[model samples]
Target chain A: MNKIIFYNIFRFIVLVFIQVVLLKNISLYNLNMPLLYILFIFLLPFNTPNWLLFFLSFTIGLTVDIFSDTLGLNAAACTIMAFLRVFYISITVQSERLETEVTPNLSTMGFRWFFFYTLLITFLHHFFLFFLEVFDFTAIINILIRATLSTLFTVFLIFTAEFLVYRKKVR
Target chain B: MNNLWRFISKYNALFLFIIFFVTSIILFIRNNDFQRVSTLNTSNQVVGVFYSKVNNVIKYIHLDTVNKELVAENMLLRNQLKASHFNDSVVVNTVTDTINRVQYQYIAAEVINKSVNSRNNYITINRGSKHGIQKGMGVICPTGVVGIVWNVSPDFATIQSVLHQDTKITSSIEGTPYFGPLIWDGENSQIATLTDIPNQINLKKGTKISTSGLSVTFPKGIAVGTVLKAGVKGGGSFLNISVKLATNFYALQYVYVVKNIFATEQQDLENLNKTQGNE
Candidate 1:
């Protein structure tokens, strides 16, 4: 339990640093702004307490918001992501494996489950984020285009980061 | 008591989620922009220190570009001095002065941080309250108007950049008296929309657009942009004008904060007019 707490704390700082210091400056063809920091929420230990999960999600989002000068967009999206995550995991994870699964990382959840999990969460996060950011019905097409492109870019980056971290466990 | 504790434990997650989510939305909306901005912006102490440190390193990489802009601005200022347009029009009148006093002063600041991608983009500058920077001051680069200062800390300030959705500047064509509010379409950072020009007016393409001096923030006659293309909209009475903004926000580094000395007086007079009309 203590080890898990320490690991999450370390992950939070590293992910936020990578996000604000590095990824914030990168864009693909000036269209997609990849947000890989959402991976931190995705990789949290599967059994993290509900209250803790909500707090952690909000904190991580708020941290990104501060650096980017996006006041509450990230925070609101991440909080919604956390709320949905509970329902998602309950439906996706098999009952027996739920007890054994320590975390929702590439190594622990297996490739298929983790990939699908990340895909769904990343899509929803980007959708919510872009919608709130645009806040206009007239530009629905613009919002969709941005949300789709950014989600793909973010998912690709998240996959790369996960592969680099868990390469040995892949086999 | 036991039942109450059990009920709380059973639905604790829902309760917590609602609380956090609501708070996030409130902070997001920022009903009182002034109050929310000062405390939450990058200019605040702890966050400002961290971002400024990073900005110090990043600014070095763009040193050449910044220097070139400074050189260009210097040349422009020198040319204006040679021309000296301000005093040229001053009439020698003893009883009634015709030339209005310069109502704006400028404070130079460096753009330590900025984002053009977001819907409501903001730029942070090295100047703040300590440097006489204040909320509602206009920020402009050498090329054109950039934004309005929305928040200020002790040593840093944040600007609501022209790229933002909420930003609207009063502008008009150079030779015409017709004016409209310039707004961003949120489609391209370089392009902004000028609305409210009557359909009857023939707005030629490539006409120069400038600030109307109708707002307390921006002084009249600053170069805003040029009309890219314009036409009457389908079933609309106004011209659909596209303007190519002069300032390239992506490369913006140095900016000037325009302090309007008469802002308070103008606001007070306007308010007095409103109250008197109501009475």
Candidate 2:
């Protein structure tokens, strides 16, 4: 338990640092920015309390907002994403599987499950974030294009990170 | 009461989600006002320091390009020197030497953080109120206009980039009396739209666009962009003039925050005129 706590703290700092310092600069044609920090929320233990999960997601989002000068935008999107994560996990993962795996990742959950999870979450987050940032129906098409492109880009980066850390037969 | 408590406990996650979501939305709305949530932004000390430190390392990689831009700007300044020009008319002594009083002051700053991908883009500079950087000051790079100062902290300031949706720059075309407000379409950082110029005027491609000095923010005759296209859209009387912006936002590393020394005096006189007209 202590090890998990320490690991999460470390992950939080490293992911936020990489996000503000590194990923923030890597936009493709001023359209796609890979938000890899969301992966930190995805890697949290299954049994983590719901309130704690929401709080952590909010904190991380707000931290990104603070760095980027978009105070509430990321926090709102991240909170919605957290709610969806809880709903999705409850319907899909069985209680027995949660006890054994502890956390969901490409290694524990396999590529298929992880891919779908990352896709849905990333798409929803990007869609909400971009729309909120624009706040105009006239540019709906532009927002849609940006959101879709960024979602795909973020998911690709997440998968690459997962593959890098994947150990053979860790289970 | 017991049943209500039981219900609340069962759906605590939903309640928590609602609370957080609403709070975030409130913050988002409140954040639109620059002065309200000043500390919550990148201009705050901690985030400012961190970005500047990171930028210090990253700036080294762009040293080659930065040096070239600086050298080019130096050449332009050198060519404008009094020694570079020859006297065409007989020299005459005039007693009114006070006519050249300074109207604007510029503070040099390094761009620590910037984003062009977002619809409402912002730039964080390493100078702030401590360096006489104030809100509403105009920011410009060597190439062209950059943005307006939106918020200022002790050591950092956040600029609302010209790429933002709300950015409106009063600009005019060279060799033409027509002028209009220049705005970003929130699609391309390289392009902006100059609106309200009448369709009657025959605008050619590559006509230079410049600041008109109508506002207190920017000085007159500063290069903004060149006309890429001009035409009437949707039966509107005003011509839709697309401008290719002069500044390269992606490669931007340094900027100057312009302070109009006579801004308050100009604004006060305008306000006084309004009161007199009302009477």
Candidate 3:
């Protein structure tokens, strides 16, 4: 348990740094902005307490928010994503497997489950992020396109990072 | 009591989520106001110091571009000085010596952090109140207008870039007396919309757009952009003029904060006029 906590703490710091110092500068023809910090929320232990999940997600979002100079947009998006992850996991994973599953990663969860799970949560987070960031209904189409492109880019990066970190798939 | 406790514990996550989410939304909205001091903005000391340190190292990578821009600005300044010298000689021979009073002062600052991808963009500069930087001052690059100082701290300031939705600047087409408010449509950083231009005036493509100087924020003839396209709006007497902004926001490094000497006097007079009109 202590080892898992230590690993998560280190992961949080690394992801935040990468997102701020590296990813924030990358814009592919000004179409997509991949926000990879949300990956921290996605990789939490399977049976972590819900309240703790919400708190941790908010903290990470706020930290990113501070670096990006966006006061609350990230916090709102991450909190909702954390809240929704509970439902997303419950419906997808079997009850009997919940006890045995260590964490939802590229190695622990099958490719199909992990891919779809990351996609859905990332899409939701990006959509909400762009929505609040724009806060204007007149540019709905612009918001949608930006959200979709960013979601795709973020999910692709997350998948690549997961594969690189965990060499072999357990499932 | 037991039932209440059970319900609270059962739905703890939902309650926590709502609380956190609502607080964040409030902060987002409140921080958007020009008058508010955003805790997370780079103007804050901790954030400002970190960004400045990072920028100090990264700026070396763009030294060539920065040098070229500086050289161009230097040439322009030298030409202006030569013209001013010629005028001074003319004044020296005049019967009545006209004293030239300076109205605006420029405070140089370096951009430590900036964003162009978001709908509402902001740039953080290294100068702050300690350097005489203040909210409502105009920030301009060597080539064109950049933004307005929205918040200021002791050592840094945040500029609400013209790319933001709420930002509007008074601009006019070159060689024409007509003026309108320039606004960003949030689609592209390079393009902005100039509205409230009367439909009767024909604006040709490539016409120069510049600061109207109707407000104290900017002086007359400061380069803003050129007319990319112009068309009539659906049900208005105005033309929707598209302008290609002159400043490349992505490559912005150095800027000047324009301090209008008569801003307070102008604002006070306007307020007095409004009150008198109400009566």
Q: Quick one: best TM-score, which candidate?
A: 2
The best candidate by DockQ is 2
What fraction of the correct interface contacts does each predicted structure contain?
0.58, 0.85, 0.66
Point out the higher-scoring one by TM-score: 2 or 3. 2
lDDT of 3 by residue, A1-171 (tens): 888889899999999989887798887666699999998999889878887889899899988888777888899999999988988888888888676528789888878988999999999999999999877788788778888999999999998899798857466
Q: What is the lDDT of residue A156 in candidate 1?
A: 91
Candidate 3, B182-204: lDDT as tens digits: 99987888999999999998878
Question: In model 1 chain B, which range of ten residues has the least summed lDDT?
Answer: B31-40
lDDT of 2 by residue, B170-264 (tens): 99999988899999987788999999999999988999999999999999988999999998989999999999999999899989999999999
User: For residues A98-137, could you state the per-residue lDDT of candidate 1 as single tens digits?
Assistant: 6653877887778798878888888888989989887878
Tens digit of per-residue lDDT, candidate 2, span A58-83: 99999999988888999999999999
lDDT of each: 0.85, 0.90, 0.88
User: What shift in Å separates residue B3 of candidate 2 from its native position after superposition?
Assistant: 0.9
Best by lDDT: 2
* Interface DockQ of candidate 2: 0.85
Off by over 4 Å in 3: A96-101, A169-171, B83-98
Q: Using lDDT as the measure, name the better of candidate 2 and candidate 3.
A: 2
